[model samples]
Target: MLTCAVPTTLGPVIGAEQGHVRAFKGVPFAMARRFAKATPPLAWTEPRRCTDYGPYAPQPGQLDQPEDSCLSLNIWTPVGADGPLPVLFFIHGGAFVTGGGADYDGTFLAAHGPAVIVTINYRLGPLGFLQLHRHGLSEADNLAISDALAALDWVHANIANFGGDPDQVTLSGQSAGASMVIALATLPQARGKFTRALALSAPGRNIMSADHADHIARRVLAELEIEQDPSAIASVPLPNLFAAVERVGRRIADETEAGTVFGPVLDGSVIPREPRDVFADGTLRDVELWLGSCRDEMVMFLKSTPPAAMIRTSERNLRVAFGDAGWERLLACYRGSVRPDENPYEALLSDAFWHRPMADLARSHAEAGGAVWLSRFDHRPALEPFLSQGPTHGADNACLWAHLPDFIDRPILKRKGGPMMPADIDVAARFQTSLLRFVTSGMPDVAEAWPRFEPHRESLAIFGQPFQVVPLNEGARSRLWAELSA
Candidate 1:
C-alpha cells in the first residue's frame, strides 16, 4: 500500500495505492445542489481519504440510494510512472438519467498504458437535465453539463500531480455520455480544454430546443401532479421524481420519437446550438475525433420492452430521424442487409438512429478538415446463452475496461463473460492500444494503422474477430445509406 499527496488547485489530496495503480476514488471535483451550477470544493488542510466510491446522482433503477452531491470523479494512475502521461477523461452513460463513474473500473487501462484514467459523475435526470429556463431558473439549466465542465476544469488544473498530461487529455464517453462529449466539444467554454475525443454510440440528434424542453418539463410536472412551482418540484422525493421522469420519458419517446427525455438542450446560454450545427459550422475543427456505434445497439435496449412497442418505436424513430421520404430511402438502403427471418426493424433502427448519425458526424468532421477516425464494434460476447444480446449497445465498454465478468451460475457458461476466446483477449488488447495511441498521439494505432474517415472512402475499423477495416456502408443494402444522408 502506497500513498501520495496529489496537489490540486484547491489543495493536496491523499490517494491510496492498489498494486501498480494508484487509485483515487470518489474525489469531489465540485459541490452543487440540485439545479445549480457546480462550484469548486472548499480547500482542505488535512488529507482527504479517497478510497471508496462516491454517491451516485439520482437516477432511475439505481440500486443504491442517490445523493445531491454527485459531482465526483475517480482517478487511476500507474504508481511509479513518470509525469506527463496521457489522460482519459471518461463520462458514463445512462440515457442522461442514470449511471456514475463508479460503474467502470479504470485499473486495467491505467496499469497497462502510459495514461491516467479519470471517470466522472455528473447530475442526471430532472436535477441535471430538466430545463429550468422557463421556470425562471435558466442559470441552472443543463446542470449536468455544467458539472462535466467543472470536472474537466478540475482535471486541467490538478492532473499533473497525478502524473497526467492535461495537455494530452482525451475526452471520451458512450451513449448519453457520448452525447455530452459532443456537446462539450461544441461549447465555447469547453474549447481548448481537451485535445481529442472519442464518442461511442452517440445519438447526436437527442439534443432538444428550449421550447421542446419546456414542453417536456411541463408534462413532467403535470404527470407528478405538481404545480409549476420549482421549489415544490425540487422538494419532492428522488424516487417520486425518478418515477415521473421515467413516465414522462416514455411518453415523450412515444409522442416525439426522441432518444431520451432529458438531455443537453439548446438553452441559448450554456449550449448555444445543436452539436450537429456546431460541427457543420466548423466549430469542432480543432478537436480530433474518433466515434462509432455497435452493430445491434438499439436491440439490446428494445429486447425487454414489449415487441409491439419496440416496433412502433423503431418506425417512429425512422420517421422522426429522416422524415417520410428520407425514412423510405433509408429503409430501402438497410433492408437487404438484415437476415431473412430476422425482424428488419432492428437493423433499420440501428442504421437510422445510431450508425447513420455517426457516419454523418464523421463526414462533417472530414468536411471541416478535422482529423477523424470511424469505427464499428461488432464483437459478440460469449454471454449469448444467458444475455443473448448481440454486440448490443455499450458492449464495447466491457472489452475496453477489461472487466468482462464471469457468469458464475449455469455450469457451461460459468466463467464465460470476458475474453472467453483468444480473439476476445486480442481485441481487448488492441482496442486498449488504439485508445492509448489516440490519447498519447492524435491517431489510433490499430494493427493495420487506421486511416482517416473521408466521405468518399467511409473506411471504418471494425473491432471483432480478425479485426479489420472496411467501408462502413459496404454491404448490399447499406451502400445507398450514404447517398440518402447526402
Candidate 2:
C-alpha cells in the first residue's frame, strides 16, 4: 500500500493512496467531554496513522460503538492537483441523532472534483443537543454546531497542507446536516470561514425555540429521574441517556409533529435567530448558495408510516402547524397538485416541512442580493425500492454520490445486486458535473440555462434524464404557499 504524509499544525499524518486520491481517515480535529464545547486536539510530535475511520456519536442501533471523543474528521485530496483546490466540508445528517463522518467516503468525489473533501463527526442526540442552560448546565447549548465550527477552524488552519484552498471552502450538507449548513451560513462564528454553501433537503423550519428545547431537556431529566440535579446528566449511562432520548423524542414527535427532537436551538447567543430571518435581513448576501431538494422528499418517511396513522397524524400536525383555516387551504391546494398515487397529506406535510421553506429561503436570499441557485432532484433509479418511491429523500444523495458504495447500499435505493440503468448513470454524471462546477466556480451552469434564482421569477433547475429550468412557484400549491405567506 502506498502511503503519503502531510504535516498539519498539530503533527504529521500518514494517509494512504487509493486510486487517484490520497485519503487521511480518522484524523482528530477536536475533543470534548460530554455536553461540553469542543477543543483542539492535543499536538503530537510523531506521525499519526489515519487509515481507518473514527467512532460515531452514541445513538441507538449504530453498527459501530459510539464514543464521546467523536470529534474527528476525514480528508480526501486529489493526487495531482495543479494548484490549491477548493474544499468541500460536509456534515452528515441523521436528524441530528445519528450519522458520522465515517459514513461518507469522499475518495470518489475528491478525485472527481480534484478538490479536497473533509467530513467530520459531531455530538448527536441528547449528548450534543439536549439544551440544559435553564437547568443550570450552560455548556450543553449548541455543542454539535460548536463541534462543526471547531472542525471548520481546524480545516481552515491545516487543509492548506493537503492542497486545499482555505478561502474557497464550500460548506455543504443534506437533511439535518443541510440544516446545519444553513445555520453555519448565518452564524457569526462561521463568517469568513466558507465562501459558498450547498444545502440539500434542508429542514428550514427545524430549529427549536428556547422554550421547546428547555421543555425537551426537562422531559429528558425527568425520564432520567434526576430533575433536581441536572448535572447528573453528564454521568448517565449511554444506554440510559439514549433510551430517554428515544422516549422523549417519540413523545414530542407525537405531540408536536416534529420530525426530530434534537437540533440547533434559538439560544439568543449561539444561534440568535432563525436562519430564514438572517437571509431575509441580508446577513448572508455575500455568500453564494446552491440549494435543492428531491421531488418526493417525504416518501422516505411515508413508506414507514401506516396509511391510517399517516393521515391522522398528518392532519393533526397540519392543524397544529397551520391554523384551522390555513390547514384547510393548504390541503385544498395540495389535493390539486398531488398525483393519483400520492397521498395528499404526504404532499402537504412535505411542503409544509421541507420544499416550500427551501423556496422561501432561496427567494429571501435572492431578494437580499445574494447569488442563489435552486434545484429539484427528479431522477429516480429504475429499480425496486426506488421505482415505487419516485425521487424520495436521499435520492439526490444517491445520485450525486453514485460512485460511492455507501450511497448505493443506502436502504433508500437498495439495488439488490442489480446494475444501474443507463439513465441512472447519465443522471449521476450530470448531477455531479453541475455540483463540481458550483464547487469550483460558484456557479452550476451557464447563465441562460441555469439563471440565478430571483424573487420575482423563482427559476428552479430540475435534475433528471432531461434537465430543464422552470418557474419555481408555477404550480398551484406553490402559489398558495406564496399567498398564505403574503
Clashes of each: 0, 0
Q: What TM-score fits each model?
A: 0.91, 0.93
Judge candidate 1 at residue 485 and give its lDDT: 50
Q: Cα lDDT of all candidates, in order?
A: 0.78, 0.82
Query: Worst 10-residue stretch by lDDT in candidate 1?
Result: 406-415
Per-candidate alpha-carbon RMSD to the true structure? 3.6, 2.7
Clashes of 1: 0
Top candidate by TM-score: 2
Candidate 2 per-residue C-alpha lDDT over 1-486 given as tens digits, one digit per residue, 9 for 90 to 100: 547568998899999998999899989988888777788778998889999887767777752454656889999999888759999999888778877777677887889888899988888887788898777785648888898988999999999999999999999999999999898888888889899999999874657788888888899999999998888988888888888888786677666554447788888888988878998888889888999998877787778654323334556766775679988998877787778777787778777667778888898899999999999998887655567888878788767766732234443112332466788888878888888888999998989889989877889899996999998767787677767767
Query: Residues 1-486, candidate 1, lDDT per residue (tens digit)?
Result: 648677777777777887789999889889886666788878787778888888878666663544656778999999778778999999988778767787777887888786899999888778888886677664668888899999999999889889999888999999999999999888888877799999999974747777888888888888888755665776778788888877877667667645356778888888888888888777778788999788787787567645424356667765765689987776665565567544476777777678878988899888987889999888875655324777888767767876423211211112234334566667767777888888888789643567888767778899987778887765655656545556
lDDT of 2 at 21: 92
Residue 349 displacement (Å), model 2: 2.0
